[model samples]
Each structure stands twice: as structure tokens, then as C-alpha cells.
Target: MDAILNLRENAARQGEKTLTRPTREEAEAAVRTLLLWAGENPDREGLLDTPKRVAKSYGELFSGYNESPEEVLGTTFEEVSGYNDPVLVKDIPFFSHCEHHMVPIIGKAHIAYLPDDRVVGLSKIGRLVDVFGRRLQTQESITAQIADAMDTILHPRGVAVMIEAEHLCMSMRGVKKQGSTTITTTFRGTYRDDANAQARFMTMIRLG
Candidate 1:
């Protein structure tokens, strides 16, 4: 719960401040250290290049840290033909690493918002999901981040976000419960105040 709150409070802090990062050489050295810790020879013929590969892969996997949600959602179209209904983008495929285990949490996201005066491009919602998913996250954090971004950036009437994911920390380790799934959701504005609106969002996600 504290982690989620910290994430929400810090959501707007990204792209607003300078972030310090390690260089590629430093990252590669860290991977080699991990290999040694795992009882593997870093100098072995086959493993000699493994550190470089892992470092490169980590750059792609965690690139979300370099992206800005405000910039991704900056543009909006007021010419939505006077449309004020809910705009939903469902089943947006995404995979994230669990902050606890740094293992995969594969899932789909369903995002819906009640537009006020304007609407954003549909593709922006998918991009928004990726912006958060490519980071070390808890399912709950991603769910809240999506809803918070839409709510803050678009100033929509309401926002609803649902994420269904399988955490590898639970499936591949800990309890080792394979195939188990977890769902997390965040509702804001009208979706939080009105039961009917929230129910309709659920129905659309289920039927679609």
C-alpha cells in the first residue's frame, strides 16, 4: 500500500527532474558479478559474452524509465464529434518484471475513460501501457499509474483501468503455483462515484 502511494505521489516527478544512470560498461560488469555469484565462470568461453548480452537486453526491458507519460499523452483532439461516451482500449498486451523478483509478469490491460471536451488518440493508450510496463512494477502499481496518467493528462470525466497478469514470482518461485493469475484495478472520478458506470465498464471488458 505504501509503495502504491509513493508511486502515485511520484508519478508527476518523471521527466521533471534529472535522473542519474549507470553506463553500459558498469551494467555489464554487474551482470558478470551476478554470474560469478551464481557459481559460474565469467571467463568461460561461452559465458564470456553473456554479460554484454544481458546488459543490452536490460536496456530494452527497462527503457520505460526514460519515457515521459506527459509527453506521450500531450496531444488531444477536441473534434471528437461531440462524443462524450466512454472510450475503451481493451486487451492491450504487455509484460513487466516484478519489482520483488525481477521476473516476468505477463498480462493484458483494459483502459477506459469518459471524455470531457476532447479525446486522445487510441494508440496513445497502448503506448501509455508500455511506458509503465517496461519498468520494475507491481501489478497494482501499473494499474494505478495508467489510471492516474489518463486522469491527470486528459482531465477526463473518469478513468478505469484493469490489469490481469500472472506474476512469475508466485508461479516460478515462492509458492510455485503455475498458471495462477492476479487482477488489479483502479477507478477514478465518475467510475468511483457511480456504480452503474463502473458496472458498465466491467461488462464491456468482459464482453469485448
Candidate 2:
């Protein structure tokens, strides 16, 4: 678990080398380029200020880059009074952008973990979901990331993350399959090894 923590921290530090901070003007210019590519007149009366607005919106939409889930889960209470059981947070609403099309993926995440000697704040679990959900991600990757975060940080006996979402890329275009939903799951430790524990998590979420 310590190695997992160090690996993620090192990865984040290494990832910084490939990134260059662009100025607001540069960001706005890129938006204008997209507008031109989309066949929209950037100088038109209706779209003149659109580039700046879109640039600002992107900052808000992808703010996850500035956050860390491990930090958010950093504070835990060991005074759980020997309550070493599964803690679950279900139907945590989140909105993410699909990396493939840069479109919306609306969903709910159901997260659970069996604590060892420490338990995190319940709201932190929901916030953990939001941190990852705010980034451009695939449903599969995000699900796995959440489970792994819990496993490494809380050192839980097990961790389970299930995400159910509808991607705008699929619903609004492509096959135009409306009402289509995608579900993904990741399990770690006991959740991965024990069938009954897994079944209990599933049943609890279904009842919710």
C-alpha cells in the first residue's frame, strides 16, 4: 500500500514534465481555432466573445487536474471503535467528460470499502468520486482509480467502486442510441476474493 501511494505520487510529479502552462490568451485563441474549424465565424456578432467564455468554462469543467483524491482522503478516524466493516456510499452523483469525444458523461457512483483500523469521512467518499469524475476519463479507468485510491489510502480490507453512466457521445451521435447506459466496476482485496461480500455490496446498492 505504501508503494501504491508512492507510485501515484511519483507519477503525478513525473506527469508535470510533459505539461506546459498556457496563458488565458492562448487558451482563448485555441477556442477560436476550434470555432473556425467548426465553420463558425469567430468575429460574428453572436460569437464574438464566445472564445473567452468557452476558455473560462473549460477551466471550471476540468478542475480535477488541480485536485488530489489521496489528499482528500488523507484524514481518517481510527477511533472507529473497532468497527471493522464495510462502509458504503451509494448514488453519488457526478458529471464527467468522455475523453474520446469531450462530451458529457452523467452518472452515479456506488463506493464501498471494508475498513481495517481506520475509516474515512463518509462525505469524503462522495468527494473522492467527484474528484475523479471531474476529469476527462473512461468509465472503466475512473472506476478502477476510485477503488485503488480507497485501497491504498484507507488500506481497507476490500474496496468496490461501481459507476453507471450515459455518455453524450453515444446518445447524441454515433449510433444515436438514446437511453443507453454503461456500467463499470472495480474490486480490490476482500471484495475481489469473497463472493458473499461482493454479493452483499451489490444487493445493498440495488436496494437503494
Candidate 3:
């Protein structure tokens, strides 16, 4: 509970931090040290700018940490036209970091909700995934966070989230299987109790 609260607070603190651009010189120095330790010459022209480029790329790849899922889901539309069935957005691609290894996890997320009275914009679901996915996460927590966010924001009859990912830590080392994937899911409210509804959701997402 305390951890959840801290996440909420941290989300609120997004955009307050001073944007510090990492120095190319520092990155080059670090790379030099790495290359030296690995018995290579860092001064080689081919690898000279690799460190700076990598540092810049890191800034872009990890920028999601400075954003918030709650704020992304803040916009709500009560004008759902009373046509509430299941609003599902599937195959939402997300790139996240694994907290355990600090390596990348790339995945597709499926989100579905049965609205109560209010509904959110379609894009908000994607944004929510981005918010949660950008942080250091385990697949289990990522699944639960999406469900919880939808339950909180939409007060939906049910909310379901499914994630399928391939972790680099698993693929790049330690019994490496190149084609392996992991699936994690979370279901809330009616989706949790009603097998038929869950089945429908799974079928829908599984469809190509």
C-alpha cells in the first residue's frame, strides 16, 4: 500500500526535475574505461562516438520515467453515448525496463473495460500503458497497475489487462531461448468472476 502511494506521489512529481543533459565527454570517458577493461582501444575511430550516441539514445529510450500514468488518464469523457459494451484496445506495443536486470522488455498489451457510466478516450489506454511500461517493472505489477488504473479512473464494471513480453535478460543470457515469450494478466470486478467474459476477452486479443 505504501509503495502504491509512493508511485502516485512520484507520478505527481513528474516534470519538476531539472533536465540535465549528459555530457558526451563523460560518456566517452566511461566507454574508454570499459574498452580498456575489456582489453580494447577506445581511441579507435569506429568506436569513438559510440558512447555519446549511446548516451543520447538512453535519454530517449528512458524518457517515460519522467511522465505519469495517472495524468495521462486524467481526461475522461462522460459522453459515452450509452453504447457501453466492451471497449478493448489490443496489441498496444510498450517498451519497459526490467527492474531486476535493468534490461529492456518489449511487449504488447491488451486492455478491455466494460464501462459503468463514464468512459475514457481510446488513446488514454495506450498512454496508460506507456506510463506504466516506462518504469522499472515486473510483468505481474505491470498487469495489475493497468487494471487498477482503469478501475480507479473509469469505475468500470470490469477491467482486464494482458501483457505478452520478451525480456532481454532472459533472451540474451541464462538459458537463452531466442523466441521465448512471457504472458501475464490481470482481471478486475466482473472480469475476475465471470469466466465467459474473460474468455471472450482472451479470444478477442488472440485473434490476429
Candidate 4:
């Protein structure tokens, strides 16, 4: 299990490349180019400020890249009086952009971790979701990253993550299936080994 997790982490690191980020002015100029590509005049009265607005919006939308999951999940509470059960946070609403189309992927994530000794704040779980959700991602990568972060940081007995989202790339473009939703899940350690554990996690999500 550790080896698998290490491989995943290594692969993720290998996939990352350092690139100099563009200045806000440069970003706005790029937005203007995109507007032109979309067959719109950037200098039009109504569109004059659109590039600046888009640049500002992108800063907020992709802020996840500036955050560190280790910082978010590093702190844990060990004061619980032998309380070691599945701690689940469900229906955490998130908005992400698909890596392929840069369109919206609106979804909710359900996360559960069977703690070995310590647990993180419930709100931290929600924040953890945002830490990944605010970046370009696929639902599958988000699901796996959440579960992996929980297992790796908290040293949990198990971790379960389920994300259900509607990808605009598919709904608005390809198939044009407006309401179609995609679901992805990741289970680690005990949840992966025990069917009952997985079932209990699902039950908790459903009951929530």
C-alpha cells in the first residue's frame, strides 16, 4: 500500500513542471486574445473591461495551485477519547474547471476516513476538497487525490472519497447531454480490503 502511494506521488511529481507565471497584465492581454478568437471585439464598450475581469476571475478560480495540501491537512486532533470511527464529511459543494475544456465541473464530494488515532477538523475536510477543486482537474484525479491525502497525512486506517459532478465539456459540447453526471470514487486501506467498510461508508454518505 505504501509502495502504491509512493508511486502515485512520484508520478504526480514527475508530471509537474516549473513554469514562470504570467503577469496580471499579460493575463489580461491573453484574455483579450481569447475574446478576439471568440469573434468578439475586445475594445467594444461593453467588452472593454472583460479581459481584466476574466483575469481577476481566473486568479480566484485557480487559487488552488497556490495552496499546499500538506499545510491544510498537517494539523490533527488527537484528544478524542479513543474515538476511532469513520469520520465522514458529505455534500461538500465544489466548482472546478475541467483540464481538457477549461469548462465548469460542478460537484459535491463525500469523504470518510477511519482514523487510527487522530482526526482532522471537519471543516478542514471541506477545505481539503477546495484545495484540489479550485484547480483544473478530472473528477477521478480529484477523488483519488482527496483519498490519498487523507490516508497519507492522517495515517488513517482507511479513506473513502466519492465525487459526483456534471462536466460542462460533455453536457454543453460533445454529447450535449445537459443533465448527465459523472461519479468517481477512491477507497484505500481498510475500505479497499473490506466490503463492509466500503458499505458502511456509502451508507453514511446516503444517510447524510
Candidate 5:
């Protein structure tokens, strides 16, 4: 609960000011250290530029750390008179790196919220996913993050978030099932307390 509150507060703080962190050269040097530690020659013909490439890739992959979904979600339109039904964005695919192993987590997210007055733009839903997805994450934290972000920014009556993903860490190492997927969900407000609302969200996401 405290963690989620911190995230919400952090989201609110975004767009207000910039936060400083490590430099790209420092990140590249770290990656090079990992290469050397992995017993790979960082100076080899093929690997000579690998660190720079990795640094650039890492910039793109974890860029979410520098962004806030609340900024993207801040815009809204209240033209939704008499249309207070739950708004849903389903089968939205995203790519995230697992914080546990720094490997890919390929997934689709299903997001829904029962509106109070206003609604956000459709693409903003995907943008919200990208904002959270570009950071290293666990499925559970990401689930709560999405729903919480929506609840905070949209001030909705309820919010629901479900993420289904295959973690490369699970598939490429450890027990290595190679095909298992993990699903996590978070619900808030009416979605958390209303069974009917929860079932409707599930049914809508599953619709053909």
C-alpha cells in the first residue's frame, strides 16, 4: 500500500521537474564490466561495440523510469453524457523487462475502468502501458501500477488491470518450462468490491 502510494505521488511529481540519475557512459561501462565478468572479451572484433549498443538499448528499454504515465493520462474529455459504462482497452500488447532476471516479459494487458465523469483518449491507454512497460518490473507490481495509475489520474469509480505474460527468465533458465505464462490482476474501488462489475470486466475482455 505504501509502495503504491509512493508510485502515485511520483507520477504526480512527474512533468513538474526532472530527476537526475546515472550517465549513459556510466551505464555502458557497467555493461562492459558485466561482459568482462561473463568471461567475454569486451574488446573483441565482434564485441568491441557491444557495450555502446547495449547502453543505447538499455536507454530505450528502461526509458519508463524517466517518464510518468500520469502525464499521458492527464488529458480527459467529459463529453460522455449518459454513457457511464465501463471503458475498456483489451488485448493491448506490451514488452517489459523482468526486474528479477533482466530478461524480456512479453505480454498483453487488459485494462478497464468505470468512469465517473470524463474519459481519456484511446491511445492514451496504450501509452500508459508503454510508460509502465518500458521499466523493469514484476507482473504483480506492473498490474497494480496500471490500475493505480488509472485510479489516481482518472478518478474513476473503479479500475481493473490484468496482465498475461511469458517471462523469459522462467522459460530460458531455472526450471525452464519454456511455455508457461503468468497472469496478474489488480482491481480498485467498485471493481474490487462489486462481483458483478468484476465478472462484466472479465466477460468483456473475453468477448469475440
Candidate 6:
């Protein structure tokens, strides 16, 4: 049991270390290289400052890569007016980049959690989504990360997250499915074990 606990602690430490931001210069150089790889001259008049601009833009877009979702969810409110119901925050807008193609994945996320003894501010849910979404990631990882963050911080009875996104890599380049959207979901604890609870959460999001 001690060994298991130690291992878990080590893993958590490693996860914390992974949350770091890149230096501005590094981001700029990467953007420059990307432009060159795309057969564009980074030195061209119109493209001269493009690398810096892209780097700055990436600092905002991928800022989540440096942020800890657990940290973002640290503060909780105990006063809930005796409301012991599932807290649902839906249709939170998000933008992410596909790690594979580096193209945009634009979407909305629906999140719900059943509190155990504590509940987070409603805006925190949206902020949590942004913290994970503003990075180069897969939809699967993004969905799972949000669910895991809520589960860990809130220690809730259950957590559920669903993301619906359209990938520009597919729609703008390969196969070009313009109107197609991909849906990904992750559920923890009761959200996974109870069908009715999951169905109700999904229904609420769909209706809205």
C-alpha cells in the first residue's frame, strides 16, 4: 500500500512538471520554421513580422499547455443554498489545434458535475475548459482532461464532459468534409455508471 501511494505521488509530481510554457523566442523560431516548411519566405515584406505575430498568437492559444487545470479548479464555494444537484455548464466556446496537422479545431464543450460536499463557481467550469482547450491536442485527450480535472478538484460524485468540434485539417485539406463535426465525451464515477444521469445531462445540452 505504501508503494502504491508513493507511485501515485510521483506520477502527480510528473504531471505538474509537464505544465510549462515555452519561451517567446522558441515559439517565434518554431513559427518561422513552419512558414519555411510551407514554402513561404518568412523574410518577405508582408511575412516579415508574421513569425512574431504567430508566436504571440500561440502564446494565447496554447497558454493552456502551461496552465494546470487542477490549479485553475482549486478554489471552491461551500455555500450552495442546500442545492445538491448536478451543476451543468454548457455551450462553452473553445478553440484548439489538432496536434497531428496543427490545424484549428473549433467547438463548444458541455460540462456537468455532481458535487460531493463542495461546488465550484459556475465560471470556473468555463475557465477550466479554456485552460485545456487552448493547446495542441487530440479531442480524446482534451475531453478526458476536463473530466479528470473536475473529478480531481471537486472530488465530485461524478463528472461528465462532451466536446463537439470541426477540424480544419479534414474540412480544409484532406477529404474536405466541410460540414462534418466530431463529438467526443468522457464520464467519470456515477456519470459512467449511471445511464439515466448521463442521458439527462446529454439531453439538457442537446435541448439548449
Give the winner by lDDT: 1
Better of 3 and 6 by lDDT: 6
lDDT digits (tens) for residues 1-208 of candidate 3: 3334554566667944433444667766777787789998767898877778776776567656666667888878788678778889999999898989888999999999998878889998998888788778899988998899899877899998999999998999887878799999989999999999999999999888
Could you give candidate 2's per-residue lDDT for residues 1-208 as a string of tens digits?
A: 3334544665687884333467889989999999999998999999999988998898778777667887899999989888987888999999999999999999999998998998899999988888888788999989998988888888988998899999999999999999999999889999999999999999989993
Error of 3 at 182 (Å): 0.7
Query: Which pairs clash in the backbone of model 1?
Result: none
Clashing pairs in 2: none
Q: Give the Å error, residue 87, model 5.
A: 0.9
TM-scores vs. true structure, each candidate: 0.90, 0.90, 0.80, 0.92, 0.88, 0.85
Q: Which scores higher on lDDT, 3 or 4?
A: 4
Q: Given candidate 2, what's the lDDT at residue 36?
A: 93
Q: Which segments of candidate 4 are over 4 A away from where they belong?
A: 1-12, 15-17
Compared with the true structure, model 6 gives a TM-score of 0.85
The local lDDT score (0 to 100) that residue 97 gets in candidate 6 is 92
Quote the positional error of residue 100 for candidate 2 in Å.
Answer: 1.2
Off by over 4 Å in 3: 1-39
Error of 4 at 48 (Å): 0.9
In order, how many clashes per candidate?
0, 0, 0, 0, 0, 0
Model 3 RMSD in Å is: 5.3
Which regions of candidate 2 deviate over 4 angstroms? 1-17
User: Residue 87 in model 1: shift from native, Å?
Assistant: 0.6
Q: What's the distance in Å from true for residue 145, model 3? A: 1.7
lDDT of 4 by residue, 35-151 (tens): 999999999999999988998898789877767789899899999999988888899999999999999999899999888988899999999999899988988899999988888
